[model samples]
Target: MARATGIRGIWHSLPLERYTSRDNYIWLVVATVCIGAFMAAVDASIVNVALPDLSTYFHASASLVSWVLIAYLLTLATLLTLFGRLADMMGRRPLYTFGFLVFIIGSAACGAAINLPMLIVSRVFQAAGAAMLQANSVAIITATVPASVRGRAIGFQGSAQAIGLSLGPAIGGGLIGLFGWRAIFYVNVPVGLIGTLMAAAILPKDKLSGHKTTFDWWGTALMTPFLVLLMMALTEGNSWGWTSPTILGMFAASGLLLVGFIFRELSFRAPLVDMRLFKIWVFSVGNFTGLLSYLAMFGVLFLMPFFFERVLTFNSAVTGLILTAVPLGMTVAAPKAGAMADRYGPRLLTTSGMALTGLASLLLAWTLSLHPSVVMMVIELVLVGVGLGVFTPPNNSSVMGSLPSSRLGVGGGILNMARSLGMAMGTALSGTIMAVVLIAHGGVEKAGGPKGPWIPSTRYSLYVLVALSLLAALLSLFRVAEKDSSKHESMPLEW
Candidate 1:
């Protein structure tokens, strides 16, 4: 049946009670998921301005102090697949609820920490919860929605996340100014408590039995250590040099370990991650590009504030306003892109969106002379933002649309897991490259960091960002697959 006909049936054919009941339930569920998502995303951006404050509190070196953030990101990265698989086994509600509680405790602990090590330990707890929440949010949404409107549901989820992210920096900056860095962590506790309460009330209490969930424990065990070590190597390797015994040793271990994990998954009866999914070019290519997109996007994110504040000499408020260009562009363009993709196809949009991002990155890199018109720079960043807005939904729709409905949970899990891993790698890669290049070019002394002769590394980092964007564009080209026609109108290339 055609989508219009199908939608009409769903709306008009069903009794009013059916539609009303579902709407009430879905709205509550969406609210619960948004709470969880906001918690995760808010923290992700909130800490951007707090690193300096943390260093003073710990009386630690700036480089050492940075580990607080790095550790959290690495822990989040290493555990996404683990918890995502667990969500597949246990159920989203239990994991999601537990995540909020864990996050709350972690935040409280962070606010009270006495030193760097203690704070870092608390960060790990926070990360564990974030990983659980982040991995399951989309899976739950996808599982709950009907096939015909899955794209709209996913798009809404993405929009919520993007909105939350856009708010984070502003919230973080405002709190730090009013209270302190401790306030950043303190803020999560009350919000989390309310969310937890609402979720427990609104969510239904039923779960699918994962009779064979443990079938692929070997893959889990292998992938976890591989990512943990790999991110460690990437984030620290440049400072240590990739060829250093420590770096090379970790790299070798990660490679060997992941290879074994892949082989095990392929042979396992109930794989943790289905290796055969790769046989479908759409899933395979979509996953591949998803990783690269984060690599570029987060690299820009990791550095842009620094560029705005340190390089351009803007204050926190101005820096945030400038940074808003990225999300703002996405906000304005995404709905239109989704509408367009509904008419044509996702192929061109996916490919062109990435191409635009690469072009934007190139423009950004070329203009990093610290004297470019701020307005022009913001506009360029907006272009990259719009490109991402265009890319995410259609691509997500295509990938999910092509898969069987039963696998939406695992498939969603995998896609998000890939995204989290990409973010972790991007954070580490961008950090390491900036640190290494700055040290090589002018040393910490020349970099003139915002705080007293600090390392001004954001300029060099733009190169890394540009390179990652170019690579993302290349990967985006491989995600050309058609959605199931039975589901909706064929999406356009630009959409």
Candidate 2:
């Protein structure tokens, strides 16, 4: 039977004519993606501020309350590649629109939760939506926009994400102060609704390559357990004792699962992640550098609140406001960096950015004080943000631009996974290092007063970040050689 070629078919055939002008439509896609990016970034940080309130409300221990964050991050981290693959198969438009709806529903449920379990469950669903949105955000932009402006578009998105993350604590604190912790979740409902409608209306339809698509069930099955166990071990190692039986068991299990996953991917015709992508020097280096960037970024983010609150005697509100300098600097620098990357290649910009970041880390370590000057703190943070801001756009552009359109979704997914993994590692590493150092000094209490004890640990962690940043800078310098870098030059959009 012949299918009726009705309104749906016509709509698909004449997409651009039906919508706004091509340039406007491209910007619309960028705007829609930025909204989703902002929401994801905001949610990632906003919940941290609300954790104490939730702990008080639920009368739960700190360890249990911590799962609220862990569950969401774990779910998000593991499923990013899965969702990105699905976006390629099923079409990014539908997946992205559905993600917004799912996020809205999850946010509402979280706001209405009656217990910690319910809240945690809602967060898992929230993360699922987040994975969907993040997985497709870059792929969609790369597909829709012209190559010339792609860096600029990606940079704007980065700025939006940074702004959301940087402002989250302030927003969360204010909402919790006035309306309670529930308001933190409820706040996303309206924004999510708007994003959903915008995505549905404006996103370009997926141009499937007519290649036969197949799912790598075996690969996915092995991969999921590997990630879960590995992340659990990393996240819980500090509290659970790194050498404890449970941690050892998780490491062993994860190692075995990773081996199985590697075998499965090697044999499978359509692997969940095409491991061959790593063979491309640009792709591999870009992802690694990105991981280092986030590792440093989140390490700083995780440690700074403690510095402000305990060392400087600042309140939550003050700490959040002070933290805003980081993203403010990012927002200011990112777009210009992107445009510069478009004019020149990413090599110089990214290398310089990482070098600046390393310098800032060293400066912060030297300047760190029990009672630090506010001006100095702000200067260090702004420098870090600016460095990251300069590094992000060009690096992302190179990664996304390196792959063919067929692999863009997966490439973006892998890129995002690196970021999430870096964040998880950063938080865990920073906390664990500080705790160990503080303990070595006979605990925070025995060393001196609150600020006095923490300063050493903090200084040591910054030194670690300086090393990471320098390594990243070294990697960026080799990302592409000057003569052979013509491949990164802008070309016409295929999608």
Candidate 3:
């Protein structure tokens, strides 16, 4: 009893609010949040490079081993909004801190796993923790930071994520080569522990609402299954056959659940997601464009590995190194773009960014047949990265800025959910399109494996991505002006 009381006292005393001024303290919060962002993003991609190793180690089939990745994504996508709602009701500090702890434990479990199922389940657990961190990282920043610097703060977080994602493959490859696949999971342990302690020490206390609200169990129940089913269909549509009864049933069921979730949120007193938030043009259009941006970005990312390995005949190491150019460009540009957005509105930056990305995609497609020089290829990818870097932070700031402070949590949740959905959809659609194009040219067996129709199929996929990028650019043009978002800021919160 005495020990437990002492631990509680220590926890309470950990907050650094007494030592730091408001101005200085917010940046510390941003830095701490960046750790979570970095760790979560790193985990998302790091596991990819380890999948073949995992298969060999566990003696599992490719399909079964893939669940290790899929389960994490599925769980993360399904629970993001729910956890975001919980953060609003409970407190961001507690949820975010506990997220680090959960992630640490999950990482340890993954490292110590005896079999594939254990590792997969551990990944699901890790993703739950990641969902908590991601859902609140933006909300906490918005709630704590001044509007003037909010874009810059979010930009830092975006850069951390991009850097982590960019480095994951290289890091995973090195770690696995030196220490084996388990090292990838174990690496998270120390980082997560430090992040957990930092969060407890520096994060501001959550400001609880004055009034009590009921938890939206029905909304959660409906939304979770809906997302799970929807993501499953998207992730496995190609493998399962898009027209298969099982895929069709999952899609149909997900659609029904989505309708039910919408109806429930509209009618319920305290909804999981405030459906009315979408009524704000910035919030709605920002989210839509954000989804398209990721779709376009990830579609290119999904296709590039195939292009590098099969068409260019590059080794994995060379491909990974070349791919780093995209995120490197993003890392360089995101902070500057974010700062620019604060001075000038997101409209010009976002529109220009997507236009740049579309133009890059168009160039890549146009140059594919010409066999563009490696330098040219890297430059084009870097431009795409720069475009995404410029677009994300300002767009995120705009979406969060448009919301009442109270709705920031769920708002962030929806924003992240859109990103996850976009990634899943991007990979699925691009792969499906490439396969279809290949089939149209000749069967896969006859197409001669990456040498035959693959280049043309890839070019067609890039054209599709270019179209999506243009559409996102068009949508960005419609974003409500910054001043207009402020008008809606004080709207009463239904929850």
lDDT of 3 by residue, 1-495 (tens): 999999999887768766355658889999999999999998877765565456557765333455676677667777887787688678999999999999999999999999988998899899999999988898899988999999799878877888898897777767776788899899999999999989999998888985565788898899878876876676566657889999999999999999999999999887877888888889899998898888887677667766665567664456657767766777788879878999999999999999998999888887774255888888998999899889988998899888876676678778888887676566566766776676577535121244657678889989999999999999998887646455666766744
TM-scores, all candidates, are 0.83, 0.82, 0.82
Worst 10 residues of 3 by lDDT: 442-451
Any idea what lDDT model 2 has? 0.78
| lDDT of residue 194 for candidate 2 | 94
Residue lDDT tens for model 1, 1-495: 699898666533322343337656776667778888878887876676565456456664344555676677767766777887677667777788789899999999988988888998999999899888888787777767677777676666677778877777677767776787789899999999997766555555435874656646677789878887877787677657778999999999999998999889877776777776666678777877778777677677666665555466665555656666776777787788878888877888888887788788778776776467777888888998898888877777777776765566567767876777776676677777766766666545122444321234665666666666666667766665654533322321110
lDDT of 2 by residue, 1-495 (tens): 135667567446533455656547788889999999999989887776565456567875333455676667767777887887777678888899899999999999999999999998999999899889988898899998899999799877877887888788778767876788899899999999999878877888889876656777787788777876776676567668989999999999999999998888767777776777777688899999999998888777666766665567665566667667766777678879988998889999999998888898788888878656779878988999899989988998888777765566667778877888777667666766766666566545221244676788788988999899999999998886334334433433222
Quantify all predictions' global Cα lDDT against the true fold: 0.72, 0.78, 0.80
How do the candidates rank by lDDT, highest first? 3, 2, 1
Ranking by TM-score: 1, 3, 2
lDDT, candidate 3, residue 202?
90
